[model samples]
Target: MGDIRRRWTVTARARSDRGPNGLSLLPWLLMGMGALSHLIQGDAPNPVIGGLGLFTFNTLYIAIVVRAFSPCHRETPLTWGLLTALAALTFALAIGYGREWLLLFPLLGLAVGAVVRRRKRLGRITVPLVLAVGVVTFWRDGWNSFGVVYGTFISVMVTAAILALDETVRQLRATREELARTAVEKERLRFSRDLHDLLGHTLSVVVVKSEAARRLAPHDIDAALAQVADIESVGRQALTEIREAVTGYREGSLATELDRARDALSSGGIEPVVRQSGPPLEPRTEALLSWVVRESATNTLRHSGATRCEIKVGGTPERVRLTVTDNGRGGDAATAGSGLKGLRERVAAAGGTLDSGPAPRGGFRVTAELPVETQASQEWETTG
Candidate 1:
């Protein structure tokens, strides 16, 4: 809920930072008030012509500037055409009536900046436009009018830079949101896999031990009682593991899982052959391999009607390999299970590969090869 509120606030802030709009450009229209005042005073000749020119420039300026703020219309030929017409009107008026009419050049620059974003294009337009503004201002107002030229230059460059910055900020925000969503999905996948692996193995062990106890209960009460006691121990360990899995801190040990696998296989009446020979592994790698061991043993007990199972773990300094094979009728149930699929995802994420198929001798085989320095974590995904 807090995260949701934070996201909402960020969205609101982003909206508020949306830069200038069409309405914001309206205030620059006030710059034409000087010409309006001169016309009202009736101090100039050809009053009707001057009034028409001023009205036309203002109309074009408003239309072009407003369109410049809209992404859809900013690049259309119509917008460029309107801007061109406004530039022609501004230069004619500045040359015709010296003082206040020349102020429209900076407004023209602002419109150009808003519409053209690419630096190369903006440079081409501004350099020529600035040269024209300087020449016209010199002819009409004189050499002291350098301020007009400088103002036009600053207006164009600064407005373009600001709008470009706003665009970049918006892109960055979109990227951040996408990354956050990906993180949440990864964590969800990790939790689901952990739960499936923990429960799948634990339930398989419980089912096997229950069957063993039921068979021994009739004649060997002591043996049956021992089996029941083992069930209680398995149950308690499962409870602890479930708590750890929930908290996302559970780490599996290869040696511990191998011992449990032997017990589970023996209870299911399958001879277990376990072997390990490798340099000490990183905790992350061992945790990954332990999950493989647990899932394989569960499948062997529940799916393989085999009399024997062989589990081998061997590695060099750079790579490690694990193979679980059972002398059963291909153990199709193991290959079809979600547990292997999930393990595959975890291993692949850690830069490893997992393969499951029938062994050459006509039994099911599960093989996994990982870099010795694997970075796979315990909370990684498992399908089942």
Candidate 2:
């Protein structure tokens, strides 16, 4: 869970710091030319003054593309919004007081959109604000020109594209997060099952030894001490096996996993029905299937309260099938939480299919089929 939260935070910080790309450059160039003509052409102070102010405004807006992207705080949303508002206000004054100011109104919306990235209501209002104010001011008066309409259409298209891009980014981020969650859950499941397998065998051994010692203590002190000694040895051995199991799983080798599973289920009172056919498998595939056996048997003992676990490992020229089924408390995989989720990721990552559910005969069943692109068939083999 902590990992999930951290991932999201990292994504947000990165996204918030991103700048508008080169896609916005064309409009800036067009606007820059208009500003240059108005500033440089006129002799009168009025036209010159108006042009210089719009030019300054246009320059500030352009500078944001670089400044906001910088590591500095200039690119912050607040900075962009405030500065853009100032630019729009200056632009409005340059165009004169009436509907011409409305033509520039849509630009002011950058302030609202930047601060509220996902607000649909704000966008709904903003588009209409742009169209309404723009058409009335741009196409309304005797001063209206075709240039204004063309510019308006272009701005609208640009805005729509920007919105679409933003939405796409958000969706991708969401998908990545969901996958991460699935991975963590599967890991937890694997750990829990392994832990159960390890401890169950040791505990049962301890109980049996203790009972034997109780029966013999009145007659022989040495025999009782031997039983106590066995308990300590079993505990230390379980701990060692646990550490080894954790390290071994990472390697994901099938042969090693089979050996490990044989050792684990035997201790936990699980009778494994192992079957193997044909030649040796890819080292990686063997490891993954082995873990599947170890984890399934462990879960069978701890959760299902079952006495026996049947593990079948077989493969044809095309694919390998590993099935572990127990007659125990079988239920939905949804109740599995993080553990099953992690297992699913492991299987999926290896291009395998996992079919886990309650068996028809009053038990839980787990069947995983992993493709063997090579030419090998592991023949029937069993261990109890």
Candidate 3:
């Protein structure tokens, strides 16, 4: 029941979102005009019964219009009873008076509009029921077949088409909402992965420096003091990096990450070698590559037991590449972590690819290739 209520609420909101002022009531007003014309035509045996029937039909018509346009429109036992009574009244008026009373056929359409709220088996149930009503009401005159058929066709078509359109709009709105949720979830995952990588690398450096200070405290007081100072500096830097990341102001550059990676590798007792053979890159491309370096360095420190690590950056005119290789116990396909997965998503978003595997000569290698010439770059070149 709660699910049904929620669905109805969503449908109502979608319908209301169609326009600022809400759906136009012009059609119902036109229907009122047609009902007035039936009164003006003066084709009833008794004016009193005709007037009463007219009033009842118009009242029920207005009720139907209000219910159909309502945002919270749902079926209830009372509503069902009202629709049943209206149908009975309509049939009674047509039977007692002449066939002219059948001009109130729009009331049947209104009933159908209400019925569809509870059951959408419109073709199987409502359509046939409406046809049966028409047959019973007009069976007295063979010539009245055309009016019955035309009336039933118009009522069914109009009601079904409007309801279908409303359902479609509701579906589209739901799809848009779902897509928005997915985008936000992806961003949250990216932020979490970045935080993990940043803290993991920073804390590892801090731990190594603290351990060095502990070992050297008695032998060389100056060297121990220097290690403690380095630990303090690393902690402060980590704090600042975390602040920047949380505020969405943190942006990585290739040069900065490479320098930091070198320091981290050397602190972890691994020799670091860096090489570059690329022209200047766009800021976005640089940031993406910087992230690749950061994630790779973190993985090397945490997973790879290596004595040496090498970083390479190279590119042609069309694309740029970054490779981080470590002469460590190599990782297999199953060893890829969340940091690597996040890196893959980021690189792909920038129209790039990331590949990681055990290198041929032993150890693990991570490679990222990003296009140098994006749409913005092409436009700049053309304009220049």
Candidate 4:
């Protein structure tokens, strides 16, 4: 936007390289005719007539310069160039028959746009430059000449208008771009979290199912086939969930995560117990806790050698908690693993805290607590 306003500012003073084109040629032609008369009749010049001719010079030269200057901000350069040509024809009319007063309209527009852009310095510079010349011609023509009065009024009004409009445009454009950038950043964050969860949980399940199939293959062929079938079915479901996550269409259920965890543990010969209490969850909190359950279950199936697992989820109006504990031949490896680290990140992002380590009583325990969601639901019900 600064660039846009600056362009209009620079154009006011800039000169063009080429001869005026299209309609602009008319002004130059008429200016040339008048200048020809001025040259021939130099010996006996009337002050009024001479001032009028000089005023025409102002219009002719400005038109030539404005037309030549092109900004790539809009339509084809050809369109701007054609507009310049049109201006030149207006300049010719001013020189021939005092029509230079018409030129004030565009100048007013440009000036108004510039002032709006907060280019006070540019306005100061242009105002004096145009006024000084217009004033001098007005005085020369004795202040009563219609051409002098009209041209001066028009130039001042048009220049102010252009300056104001230009500034307004710059500010609007800047705000629009900022909004677009913020939207993109938010979407990127969402996709990153979704991809991390999808791949992490799915891969863990795949590892566990593969191990189950391998162990059962030697003695129980039917069991081995069943394990393989579960692996395939689970993988397809994971892929579908990933597609939904990317599209932002589905809100997943906590029950589904618990169901998957139960299947993986039962198949691996571990006894699984689930105890859930408290009022029903708001959809968002349920989805988040559900994710925590899935991750914990997957880690247990893939890494823990525990035979007994206990999962408990309970909450009050102000907070919610999820705990997964396994009584197995415990080791420090799972605590130091990548799966737990990723889970910690997801938990933090959801405005919660996760603590995972060996339980003093027997095996390993993972616990997470979220305070904000229940508070939000309480607020909603009260407000309702």
The top-ranked prediction according to lDDT is 1
Looking at candidate 1, the ten consecutive residues that score lowest on lDDT are: 375-384
Query: Which runs in model 1 stand beyond 4 Å of their true positions?
Result: 1-14, 17-20, 42-89, 96-98, 119-121, 374-384
lDDT pick, better of 2 and 4: 4
| TM-score list, all predictions | 0.84, 0.46, 0.61, 0.53
Say which prediction, candidate 1 or candidate 2, comes out ahead on lDDT. 1
lDDT tens digits by residue: candidate 1, 178-283? 9999989988888888888899899999999999999999999999999999999999999999899888899999889988999999999999988887767788
lDDT of 3: 0.72
lDDT digits (tens) for residues 8-41 of candidate 2? 9999988664535524542634444444554466
Q: Point out where model 2 deviates above 4 Å.
A: 1-249, 252-270, 332-337, 377-380
Give lDDT tens digits, candidate 3, residues 1-384.
999999999999776766311133325435444435656786556767777877887666556555655556535565556666777777776666635555555556645654454345666656776676667555744556566657655675666577657767777987999999998987688679779878877887887777778888989999889888888888998898888887777888878888888877777777888887656788888888988888888778767888888999886778888988999999663235687887888899899999999988999999999998643322111000
Q: Pick the candidate with the highest TM-score.
A: 1
Model 2 scores a C-alpha lDDT of 0.60
| Lowest lDDT 10-residue stretch of candidate 3 | 375-384
Q: State the number of backbone clashes in model 1.
A: 1
